[model samples]
Target: MPKQITRAYEERLLRIRIMSHTGDKIHIKLPLDFVKRMVKNNALDFLSGKDDIMDSQKLLNLLINAFDYNLTGEIAYLERNNGDIIRLIID
Candidate 1:
């Protein structure tokens, strides 16, 4: 890691930016080496459906999954429960 990348730059660099008509903005970023590992683990398909910003649930899941945490149990539980699950998902 020669010439270390500053936190600000590193943070911005991971973002996946997109521009849209009607003055809408969309930003997506993942941690360093996220895609590489997911690729190696054969989980890159999870990155799909990201371009569809209209799918709020999908977008929320992708953002949380970015952290590589274990939320499978919670996810399964939510499948049984109801009400704007995004709160529980993100929490």
Candidate 2:
């Protein structure tokens, strides 16, 4: 039988959740491979120091690369003045 190979990027997942004051909620989950592709495709270009996205390009890159370090758990948590909450996790 041929030996099977496992990719590091395939073992990681990125999760995001947002809650609004009006009880609205949103959640997203992405595999690291997809995240990598998105980064390569510049899908995150809007996060590059943009005032609305909060200049998160570097932070996002860091999180995406974190798979190399075998990191998991909450990466970020934010609470807005309007009773909104955002959470980012890696699993």
lDDT of 1 by residue, 1-91 (tens): 6663345323322444444434445555555456436555657453334443354446445544643552222231121122211212211
lDDT: worst 10-residue window of model 2: 46-55
List the candidate 2 regions with Cα displacement exceeding 4 Å. 1-9, 45-53
- Can you list the residue pairs that collide in candidate 1? none
Q: Lowest-lDDT window of 10 residues in candidate 1?
A: 76-85
Candidate 2 per-residue C-alpha lDDT over 1-91 given as tens digits, one digit per residue, 9 for 90 to 100: 9764444656767787888789999898889778778887778553343335455776776766675676777888877677878787887
Off by over 4 Å in 1: 1-5, 8-13, 41-91
On a 0 to 100 scale, what is the lDDT of residue 36 in model 1? Answer: 39
Q: Which of the numbered candidates is closest to the native, going by highest lDDT?
A: 2
Q: What are the lDDT figures for the candidates, one per model? A: 0.39, 0.72
